[model samples]
Target: MLTALKLTAFGVVDESTLELGPGLTALTGETGAGKTMIVSGLGHLLGARADAGIVRRGAPRAVVEGRWEVGDGIAGRVREFGGDVDDGELVTLRQVSAQGRSRAVVGGAGVPVSTLADLVGEFATIHGQSGQIRLSNPDRQRELLDEHARPAELARYRADFAERRAAAHELAELESEAMARAREADMLRFGLDEIAAVDPLPGEDDALAAEQAKLMDLDELRELAAAAHEALSGNENDYDAMGVVGLTGTARKSMTRLSDRDEAAAPLTARATELAMLAADLAADVAGYIDDLVADPLRLEAVSGRRAALATLTRKYGATVDEVLAWAASGAARLAELDGSDSRIFELRDRIAGLDSSLAADAAAISAARHRAAGELAAAVKTELAALAMPHAELRFDVSDAQLGPHGADRIELLFSANPGSEPAPLGKVASGGELSRVRLALEVVLATGGEGHTFVFDEVDAGVGGAVGLEIGRRLQRLAEKSQVIVVTHLAQVAAFADAHFVVAKASDGQVTTSGVRSLTHDERAAELARMMGGESDSDSGLSHARDLLARAGRG
Candidate 1:
């Protein structure tokens, strides 16, 4: 239930605060006094989008705040949204800026706008002459029927359904992979076998290729080595031309002779001696390597075979030994899966069969319970309709099979017969606007009875009614308020006359500016307002007398 509302710079409402109460309350004013602004403010507080044009003329920003008292009825839900309420007392508020930014707060802590809307929704419903379109939406209708059928059971069923759906989805993905795998299974096995026979190791390809090139050029290498050795140190190429070491020794002896006369000659002599020693070491190495450089065909064959094995692995699996090894591991896993595909699929079918049996039983139980509830609900609605001046009308609840879903195959339709001897038809195709309002009100009254949390507001439900009918509508609204809180926006004097608290929405002009306002009326003052609604001027005697009589009767309730 809403405790209070505070508005500033919102629409034509400059600044105002309204403290609400527990029983029938009415708001009435002349045309264009901004009675609808209150509803618009409530809509904004509910997280509904608003137009910036609704801001006041001189104000830079608009704000509308509502404080709702949520006691034991929805405390758990409120706490779940990051708000704590005592017993069921929850305070929720919304603030909007002129720049189009909005904020929602619950229990003085900030929360998401959607959270605020969801939490506030559990408390009040804003039903106007247009009715609730969201409720009529196909998806919303499906949810309402499901809720009406089995709330807790449906909740658990949905949880299980999600898991089963996820498992089925996973099976589909695996099946697709398995299909592609099936076509390549033979090729994969053959290629893997070939690579295994090759048995290439990391870096083995480079080593083998280097060895093969060396073996292929062995003859040229031998000829070049012998010729190079002869040129540098052998007698064949060194007959008149001194070998490098012999020449260096001669140069060193000549420098030693000149060293006594020149300091630079000593360093030259030292360098010449160092060159002779290096020539000696090189000649020794050349002689030693000559026999070791022989090409061994057996070893060469082994190197070539290793190189070929590396080539095979690279071609079959990947560009490298490590990549081929990884493919081998994944192939092992996939082969195992392929071997067990049939068995796994059978397992899933068996599980699904068991689930189907259990779900069938659960659904049947739910259907049986719903059949009983529908009968009781229909009888109750018919009784309320009779009190609303439709004694001859009848209501029916038809539950039938729907699609296979978590909710267990139930579709419901409301059947209505508005006249004697008339065949009952579905509510959607047959009920008129006025009839719908009465029916909605009757349902609200019936369902909300003895339930937790109530702040009911009906806006102009008496639009197309008058006399006894209008009075009965007001009477029922008041009767409902006895169990909870009720507020009404009406043009009917009978309706206004029933309000324990009456607010007259009046327009005032302060020189150049005109503004709408609201003021709670006293008993005598409320009589004048009701008289005005009865199509009488403020001072009319008969209107005052009638308003007094109506108020007196409503006060007794």
Candidate 2:
């Protein structure tokens, strides 16, 4: 429920604050006195498009703010957006600058203007001349019928329709790309076969390169080994020159002779013996290495050829053998998917066929529900019209079969007739602007019977209506307000008489500036305003008497 609204520098309003409450509140004033500005201010609070022209001429910006009693539905959404809902109320603020820029704040947190729609749209509905115009659209007619008739059935049908659409989309994609996928599959298979031929192992490339270098210089390697062995241990032809092993043996014998003469020389003799043993072991290892060296051109040729094969794979697939193997593994998995395209396409088609069957069943259920509801709704609205002074008028709902759509397979139209024994025609053809307004009101009253709580704003719903019909409209609005808040902008005294609260918009002007303000009316002030609305001087005795009687008739005396 909207608790309060404040507007500053907006439209003709310099600054105005309205404290609203539950039940019907009527806004009445003379023409051009700026009653519509209240409606415009509420529109801004509801995230309607902002216009710089709406700012007061001398003001830099216009601001509109509203306070609402926060319900669970909206409070949860506020928390989702990191906003605070302190004290069970939510504050929404909108500002429009002269440069056409707009800003919105909700629950004391800045947010995009569009967020207001999600937070506030469900709780309030604004009906104006444009709303009446929308009533003529065929799609809008169908939507209203669905909303009234079979909301649950319609929801189920839409869900099934979405599933069917997704299945169809997948099937179309698979069929369109059949040839391209087949080509891709073949390329992956060819790469996998090439890698399998060499079957390279991890680290094999570097190991083979090292072996190849050694084989290429086999003769030089053997000659170097033989020279080193001869140096470590003298050959039989060079026995006259002592080798490292013979030199160390002579040093050990001299140290031992000295140690026999003096006990301290024994430590030196032990060191000489250790050096002689190490030299002998080194000579034996060199001799073995010389014997192991052998030139084999067959093994060299085989190693070189294997290295060439590995190089070819590295150049084509990866920088190294390990990387090449990784590519092959991933390619094999992808090939499996591409190769199974035919099976996947078949699966999608089967799913689509099943969804199509379910969708048809759901649509049939929705249509049946709509047909039953249409008859009942038409009867109820026709009854409402009778109280509004159209006793002979009839309302009919025409439900016919249509091709499957997201909504359902039913096409709904509202038909009307204003005279007895006349054939009912489409609403646009049979109803005048006044009849249209009454019809819309009748429908809203009927549909809103058990709906969630909302704040309904009716801007001139009594247009082209007066007399007892205006009283009936006012009565109905009062009744509607029992379940929700109602704010109506009207000029008819009969309508304004039923208001639980009344506000009058008055204009003030100096030589160079004009401004408008809104104020709640006292009991006597309301009576005077009603008199002015009745086309008489506010202080006229006869006008006040009539106003008093009207208020009494509306049960407001």
Candidate 3:
């Protein structure tokens, strides 16, 4: 709920501060007294477009500030934007410079103007002439009915509709790209077949390289093996030549005799025996290696051919045989997926079909609920219109089948008749400006039932209305304020009299310039203002007497 509004250098309002309270607060003045300026200031404070022209003549800028008793929904949003909110109280400021620049502040922190707009929208609704026109829109009509009827069902249906749309879109793309998918699958299959034919094994490439190197240097390898064998054991062709084994045997026999005479020599004898045994083992292994070192040209040719084959596989699929094997594994897996595209497409189609059936059922339920609510809403609004002095006014909701949409499969339109004999027609066709205002108020009153803690600002919603009709508008507004905060900008004395609080906008002029200011009225002051609103002299006894009677009727005297 709005608690206060302050304006400075804004249009004709040079400086004004309004202290607001619960229930209804009426703002009134003469046609040129700048009541519109108050509405403009409130609009700017709530994040409306700022026009530099709104700045008072010769002023640098126009500033609009407002305070609201907000709930956690708004308070949490303020904090999200790094603003400060104290004890559920929120402050907003909008400043428009004469140079066409604008600035907005919320809860003492700077923010984007839209942020302020969104936060205020959660708790406050501003209805003016434009809002009346908006009511004529078919979509808005549907929204009103949904708000009155089947909100939960509509939400669920929309969710399902969204899911169905996404699935259908995917299915379309998959079907359209069937040829591309098939081409990809063929490419993968060919690559897999090529890799499979090579039949490469892990580490096979490295093993083959080593074997080829050995074959290339077959003579050198054999000579090296022969030398190692002769070093470990004496050559049979040179019987007199001693090698490591013969020398260690001679040393062991000498150490054994010395060790028998002296104990220190015993350790040398054991070392000689160990050296001789190691030399014998080395000699036997070298002989075996020499025997196996025969060079065969046929084996060399075969190893070279096999290495070339492995190289071809590596060049195409990987850098080595192991990498080639890895690619084949991954390729097989991908081929399987590509091969399964038909099944996947089939599955998607089945899922989409199932969702379509489910959505149809959901839409039917929503349509049924809307039809039921259409009657209830029409009845409720009709009753409200009766109280608003539209005794012959009739309202009806026309719910008809439409193609399934995100909202549902129902199209809702409001039909109205202002007299008993006239056939109801679309709201825009039949209702005049005054009738629209009452109808708008009636719909709001019905929809806003139990909507506590919300603020409703009606900018001359009672425009083009007067007399007892105006009084009825005021009574309904007061009734609306029973559950929400209501602020009305009205010129009607009857409406002004019903206000729990009243403010009057008055203008003054010097020889060169004019400015307006607003002030809350005392009980006696309200009487004088109401008299002026009734087109009578403020000091006239008859006007004052009538104003007092209005206040008494409004229960505000």
Candidate 4:
């Protein structure tokens, strides 16, 4: 429920504050007294488009603010917008500049105007002449029916529809790229097969290159080994020049003889024996190395050929055998994915088929629920219409199958007939402006039952309606206010007479600026305002008497 509204520099309302209560509140004034500005201010507060032209002369900007009694339904949304709901109230503020810039604030947090719109249904529902026009829309009709009929089931069906839509979208993309994916898979397969045939091992390229270098210089290596062996031990033909091994042995014999002569010589003898052993070992190793040096051209060619093969792989896949192996591993995994594309496609197709079946079932259930609800809603509206001075009026819901959509597979339309024994026609085609207003009101009274705490604003809901019908409209609004806060802007005395609280918007001019001010009327003041609305002077005795009668009839006297 909206507790209050304030407007500054908005329309002809330079500055005004309306303190509201939780029941039917009526805004009444003479024509052109800016009564509708109250509704306009509320619209702007609820995120309607702001017009710079509405800004009052000499005012730089226009601002509209509202205070609402917060409920659990809107607390989460307020929190989602980074708003604070301390003290169980939410203050929403909107400002529009003459330069065409607009800003919104909810619960003291600045937000986009769209955030306010997102909270519309949960917070309030604005019904006016424009709303009546919207009621003729088939989509709007379907929405109202769903809102009253099967909200929970419709929610479930919509959720499933969203998931199914996403799956179908993915399937379409995969199918469209089928040819490209197939080509990619084939390329990966070929690369994998080629790498497998090579059978490259980690570090094999570097090892092969080292071996090939050694084999290519085999002759030089063998000559060097033979020279080292001859130097370490005496050559077979050059025995005159003793090698290190023979000379070391001669020195060892002398050291052994000296050690026997003196104890000090024993340490020198041990050192000489160690030196002789080291020389012998070195000589034997050199000899073995020379004997093992055998050069085979065929082996060299084999090593070179293997190195070239590895180089080919390195050129295409990686700079090293290890890297090439890594690529092969990764490629094999990707190839597996590509290979399973067909199976994945089949899986998605099967899933889509299953979803289609599920959607059909859910849509059927939703339609059935709507059918049941349509009958009840139509009958109820007819009853409401009968009370609103249209006893012979009939309302029918035309529920038919439509293509599956986000909401459901149902096309709903509201049909109406003004007289008995007449076939009901589409609401937009047959209903007059007056009939449309009443129909809109009837729907509101019916729907308002489900919206317990919502604030309902009706701007000229009595348009094109008056007399007994206007009285009935007032009564219906008063009844709706029993469960929801209803604020109406009217020029009809009949409707204003039924208000729990009456506010009169009066215009004042100081020759330079005209301003509209709103003030709650006292009992006598309300009668006088109603007298003015009845096209009579407020001071007329007869008008006052009639006004009193009107209020007494509505139980507000």
- Index of the highest-lDDT prediction: 4
TM-score of each: 0.76, 0.84, 0.72, 0.79
lDDT of 4 at 63: 94
Off by over 4 Å in 2: 8-14, 31-33, 49-63, 70-87, 94-115, 223-293, 340-343, 507-515
lDDT of 1 by residue, 393-511 (tens): 88776778876576666776767889999998867677776676677667666666654456766776666667777778888877777767777888888778777788877777778
Candidates in order have lDDT scores of 0.73, 0.88, 0.87, 0.89
Local error of candidate 4 at residue 227 (angstroms)? 15
| Model 3 lDDT per residue over 1-557, tens place | 89988999999888889889999999998889998887777777668887888998999999999999988877888988899889989999999999979999999999888887887777888777787998899998998898888456667777878888887887888889889988988887887788778777789989989998998997999898888777778787998888888888888888889999999888888998898888888888888888888888999999899899888888888898888888888888887877787888898889888878888888888888888889999999999899888888999999999998888887888999999999999998889998998899889888887678898888988877899988888888898899899999998898888889998888999977888988889998889999988999888999999999999999997
lDDT (Cα, 0-100) at 276 in candidate 3? 84
The window of 10 residues in a row where model 4 has the poorest summed lDDT is 116-125
- Supply the global lDDT for candidate 3: 0.87
Best by TM-score: 2
Runs off by more than 4 Å, candidate 4 = 30-33, 49-62, 72-82, 95-103, 110-115, 201-300, 318-330, 507-515
Query: After superposition on all CA atoms, what RMSD does each candidate show versus the true structure?
Result: 5.4, 4.2, 6.5, 5.9
Model 3 residue 104 distance off true place after TM-score fit, in angstroms: 8.6
109: Cα error in model 4, Å: 3.7
Each prediction's number of clashing residue pairs: 4, 0, 0, 0
